[model samples]
Target: MNEDTARLSLKIERLEALLAVTKAMVTQHDLDKLLDIIAHEAANIVGAERASIFLVTSDRRALTSKIAIGMEETGLAFSIDAGIAGYVARTGEVIVSDDPYGDERFNPRIDEETGFKTFNLATVPMYGTDEKKPGPLGVFEVLNKKDGDFSEEDLEILLALSGQAAVAIENARLLAELRLAQDKLDRENTRLRQRFLKEYAFENIIGIAPAMTELLSLASRVAESTANILITGESGTGKDLLARAIHGRSPRAEGPFVALNCAALPESLLEAELFGIEKGVATGVEERDGKIAQAAGGTLFLDEIGDMSLATQSKVLRVLQEREFTRVGGSETVRVDIRVIAATNKDLKAEIEAERFREDLFYRLDVVELCLPSLRERREDIPLLAEHFLEVYRLKSEKDIKGMSQEAHDVLVSYTWPGNVRELQNEIERAVALAKPGETIGQEILSEKVRAAAPSPLRPMADAVRALETGLIARALKESEGNKAAAAKLLGLSREGLRKKMARYEIKL
Candidate 1:
């Protein structure tokens, strides 16, 4: 071939080789492996003895070798302002050095350490797509050209290789970051699932009273079934908690547990929230799935179902009956497979008699009814629940509180918690906040209403008298600072008589 034709042939060969490098890079996702491939290809294409690709550190303070060819050890690093490679990285220029040792910009320490002689070398800057990087990503360097000193053709080849290598490096980094983020998200999701299961376990409900025990036994039995359930109780009586425990124990434990309060939204909005809305259903409203769709293959907890409007109740009834629903302003009939667990603080029977709630909807939801006892009805569980809350709040607040004083326990047990178990939980949390570190929660830290609560006059005479006597004795002890003689004097009784009464009432200081 003539000189010009030979040159054209070489150029075409180089171009084809670079195309192969690009194709190889596209398939390689591992950052370390990709860098090794790029370095090997660059050296082969340019007939170099060895090659190295250095990358800018995250802090942009230095460059470290990502792939070093013909070297037993890798990760050779130096300041970004130091060598010929640094110069190309800083200036975004290609450098061809026939005598690298003679070049002022070349650092010979690397040669001394590795015991490798460098006759000639070519360095090219690698540019990346990140605008945040103030300079080139790093430098691509090839050492000791085999035939002679590195040539202009060799520099051009290195430049093309560097460009492709830069893109490949960026893609590898992005892929690595995405995998890390996904791994972190997966760990977080697993942690949340574990926490959810622990929180809603049936044994963690904190009720041991006979009323609660019977209720829990029955609830646990029905939890495995697919029947719709209605939970009726006063507000804060743990209806929501029981529903969650049921879901966590059921066959749908792996599925979602979606909750919506029927009283929280108006009729139109509640209907849309339950059944979802179509795209362009209203101006600026995007299409979205509702709670029903979200609860597919899971459980839907409808809190305060008695408060749902009759119009919405009728739609919910259709869903329970036909196992399908249509989104508002949409014609698509969406089918669902979800267990419905509805709760209400209101008396649905009374509401039905008053012609407010639909009787048929009530019947559908009430397939299995579970009535949670009010906190007062299960007062024997108070101390256990209080201690549970104490430990929880102590850890949360990082306090050193040990337990509740007998006076505090008596007050908690005596008080009729109108807000039920939720109120007791809040009360304990409050007492914990007000209590001093290393001290027991005292009646003094309790809310004034709790401190001064007396038995209702409607209680049986003996029970009412016993509660009154207990309150008076507790107050006397508090006034006298646990001095039995002074407390008895204040209460018009001998110290021995007071001790006997204290024994009978199980009162401890």
Candidate 2:
């Protein structure tokens, strides 16, 4: 073959490779993967020493290098109007510099910083029809294009690549939105589950906090078994959810999961509720099975078991110990096979010490004691719970709420949610139903009680938050004497979360 023909054949082969790369890029719906693919392929297709793709920040005033290929230290960052690439991004035009040093707009500071010499550069704006101030959709730049200066054919190829990159970027954004919507739906389902649990709530037992994660795990482990279980928590937490989750996961899932607030019923009637009455038994005319019989082949959740009157307590104690109970006024014995789960917000140990709750009965029911952490302990779960409730109310109310504003997230993450998850759920639902659609539920959305407790920090908010975060981590580390795990715990952060913040703030210790 002739030399020209040989060269033409090689060019055709490279074009085919480029086409494949473009197809692969299009197939990527994730922005990060698409960016790296585009950056790598751009370098190979243009035969440049390096290629990088940058996304414009929301402020439209900075270019952040998201992907970099074959570039030392992997980036060229610039302000919106600062350098050649920045000018292209700022002006919506191609910027070509034959010699990096000679061009007025060529800022070789990145080369200086990375210790790489930039001989040539070709920067082009990826424009979109957004019609706002009209800026680059994104910016791609290459260093030292091979086979002479970047020609019209090279620009055409770059333009085609730009279109593909934009498509991938837009698709990635859409996918993110879809994922968010799906997450919202999942949270709504959780809210419905919470509602089911509410029907079974009693004596204001609070087991809704994540510290209850341990309790939940334990409950699920023993839920299907016939062993009696106890739910332990401070008063007013939702132990009902734990009971329901256990029942829902159990072998007797289809059977009734009956509940009674032992504290609320009269001692005389409590006996009637637990043991069945015959048709002619006493003044109560109806022949009905008691809670134990009603909960046959299922779970029976008893709330405030510690508060049962001594007389009634002895009867329950007998049923629990012997698997049998007689009706209040009838002599016939009723036998039931049941999974018993009991909750008491009172400190059972103290109750036992005070002799308010029977020691033997406590031990019998305490076969599995699930201690749910109060809201003060698992404060980290608050933001997650808040988001869950927000999603729920938004969907049910058919509001255009996108998500929590950064301010709302900050407030949520900071507050000590005294009322636990239930309180937070109530707050969010109220806000979603009350706030105007398409607007964030701000501090205004919160109850007056919570609003008053929030920090009255002054604004034009001092550039203090970033500095404060950094200072707190540093202080904790110093207090821990550089033990990172302890420092993270002191700051109420997980190890990974702490590491990320430390890296972000450049806090070495």
Candidate 3:
């Protein structure tokens, strides 16, 4: 063939090859594998034996290979500025050599390592569209051009391929980083969930008020016993905290503390979650030991026991009576030595009267009983709880927020906390996290949903006591009708008790 005719045929073939590389890149965009392929393919298209892709790293001084082909089995990384590839990556341009030995860009060290002599060579920068300052996605090179030396046509093809290669490489890198970030976020969310369960309900049992003190003392006493303990309280009154605290203090503290909220899960789910199931025992073949078995020698805190379905309540009653249960899907009877600490924010006596709760189960669990007080009943404990939550949020948020000021403390002390300790804790936590650095929490820090917007401090005891004393004296006189003995009944006091209070307040009626 003549020189022009041969050259025309070669150009068509090169275009086809370039199309093949571009098609292959679309099908497979995995960075490491693609780099290896691009290195070898670029070499083949240019009529060369070996090629390497060197990428610009975070520190822009040097270019490093994501991978190298036609070298040894060992992984290799080299610089673009130090060698021909390095020089191209640093300058963001192409470097070509007709005679590698004659060119300053050629490094003899790589030739020594690969045991392959490089003759005519060319390097082009792979530029990513994602970057502001375009760094090298890779360095595309041809080791030896065929039929004497490479031409401007070969260089154009390489540059065109380099542009496509840069986008593909950048896309792959972004995808990998995105996946890594997603995995990290998922792991962190899981950790936060675990920590929430560990700390929020179980760790926080707030207040030292008389009502709370009695409840905690009873819980501690009951923790020494293996009997089924029943707890009743208002919703959000820390019933579960009492149960978990008993479990945490019990002999089973070292064992698993498997707790289930009966109100949280439906009957079918709760049953499966509580009981063991065998592999292939039903559809979706896998075996799972129930929460009862999971608790084994530990304590199983059954929260919101009133919400348990009748059928589940019957099964639970049997477990209390017989200390055994069958798995939801398996018939084998399993006996668990779990210390049952049950809690409800509902009154079982009322539930039983309403025929919603079983009498037998109530009595069985009622072997030991404790009741937590509502936050309104413990107004004096609010300041302590608020401060506690402040410290907790301060550490959790990694902030420098100081504690609530004296005015804030007084407001917390006297305001009727309708949402209870948990609400107070959340309020303080929110306030502390939102507070500016070195700022003390004020009334503004509080959630207006709690105390009305622009909340004022509580009414002083001095301002309130006069009305309180007058009401008591009037009630005493109304009930007694000038006799203290009968008035004591209406006043919920002994005659002597009534007299002492009346004298203290200096009531005249």
Candidate 4:
């Protein structure tokens, strides 16, 4: 063949090889495998003995090898401004070195560690398709051309290959990020659905006492309103549960319900948790949306709000007053449309008098106050609550327990439940675990504290007096046909005093 024809045929062959490598790279989705393919093909296309692909780390401080051909180990890292690859990454320039040992920018430690001798090499920078990523994504380097020193034709081929590899790498990265975002969204949706199920609705709050009836009636009336709410109750009185029920019944039920415990974190961390933080606010701190931002168009439930530091209260007051806030270490004002619900076991009035809580913040959150009755004051609801819990635990444990015995029920009703409804729930769960299948829960399985509180024949003077007083009141009420005034007159006691005794002993006519 003529010399000119031979050169033209060689050009055609190189173009065909490049075309095949590009097609293979575009089809590979797995990042690690695609990088290996790129490294392998770069060497084959340039007739090189080995090749390596080094990607810049997220911090932009260094370049780490993702795939290194002819090496037993990969992931070798060096400063981004240290070696020949680093120079190409920083300057976005290509390097063609016939004698790497003589180049000042080439580091010889890699050679000493890998024990690989290099005669000629070509290194090119790979740019990302993302506009946000302005700099080169990484460096693509091939070592020791087999035929001769790497020529201009070899540099051109490596550049084309590197460009294709860069596009493929960016595509794979974007796909991974999209999948992660989709997974997070799906998980959030599942959590919201589980929280607002029919079982947790406002109508399902197990209660029948006058106090509970009144509370529920007021709550239902206010559920559709946009007014802020403050729930006050002792610990274990179902404050969080009530807050969720209110959200479920509100017009914003379709939006997210985000909660935060004001007492769970320190003052510094609490500020960041409630208001979020800017990226680079501290070492290794990434940007994120706070609970208030997450609860936009729905509700933000702050539990134990009385325990919030005075400084945090001031910032929270701003959010309540202006409906906007600035993130920690950030100046941008972010506005949100959300309802606020604050709950605490502490007396906010006392906290305000003690100069610990902000009065303005309290008034903002207390637009509609709902103070839950302690289990002691609502004794009439004990049997219903216990039965509800029994059914729940029975199904949860897969036990065949039918019901509680009368003696056990009486003991549960007599006990002064300092821990309130939560204690009763735990007790029922424990009894179900200990009871045999198809058997009723008896007093013998009750907790020692509860059983000890039961009325006994051989009791102390106080217990004997209370038991006698309870029996007399029950008899008087029955004789009077459930008339409190007539019962009090027959027992020689004022009506209010007699009513108090009845409540204390849980006496029913």
Local accuracy of candidate 2 as per-residue lDDT tens digits, 1-509:
69889779757855775677577865655677777776776777778888877778878888878777776564556787777878788777887778879888877778778887888878877765556746677887888887788776667667767767766776777788898999998798677656655543332233355555665656667876767789878764567777777777677765678998898888878878878676776664888888989998888899888788767777888888888888867887778777788998888789878878888888888998877777668766667677777887888999998677766766665676777667778878887877887787787677677776666677553457777898899899999999999999999999999999888878884
Candidate 4 per-residue lDDT over residues 1-509, each given as its tens digit: 69989778768877887777777776767888877876777787778998998899888889999889888769699999888999999999999999898999998888888888888789999998788875899999999999989988888878887887788878888899999999999898878676675656877898888998899899988988999999999998999989988988898888878999999999999999999999999999999989999999999999999999999999999999999999999999999999999999999999999999999999999999999999988888888888899999999989999799988888999998999999999999899999999999999998999999988757699988997898888888889999999999999999999978888888766
Candidate 2 Cα deviation (angstroms), residue 362: 0.4
Better of 2 and 4 by TM-score: 4
Q: State each model's C-alpha RMSD to the native.
A: 11.2, 31.0, 12.6, 14.1
Order of quality (TM-score): 1, 4, 3, 2
lDDT per residue (tens digit) for residues 1-509 in model 1: 59999899888888888878877887766778877877887788788989999888887778898899878668698988888987877788888888887889999989988999999998989999889778899899999989988888888888888888899888877888899999999899788877998998898999889999999999999999999999999999999899999998899988889999999999889989999999998899999999999999999999999888888888899899999999999999999999999999999999999999999998999999999999999999999999998999999999999888887888899999999988999999999899889998888899999988834436688887799999999999999999999999999999999999999999999
TM-score, per-candidate, Cα-based: 0.74, 0.48, 0.50, 0.57
Report the C-alpha displacement of residue 258, candidate 1, in angstroms.
3.4
Which portions of model 3 miss their true places by more than 4 Å? 1-206, 453-509
- Report the lDDT of model 1 for residue 470: 100
Q: Candidate 3's residue-wise lDDT over 149-214, tens digit each? A: 877877887888777678777788789999999999989877764564466443366667898777
Report how far off residue 321 is in candidate 1 (Å).
6.6
TM-score, cand. 2 vs. native = 0.48
Query: Which lDDT values do the candidates have, in the order given?
Result: 0.90, 0.76, 0.77, 0.89
Candidate 1 lDDT score at position 457: 35
On lDDT, the stronger of 1 and 3 is 1
Top TM-score: which candidate number?
Answer: 1
lDDT of 2 at 374: 71
Per-residue lDDT, model 2, residue 463, is 57
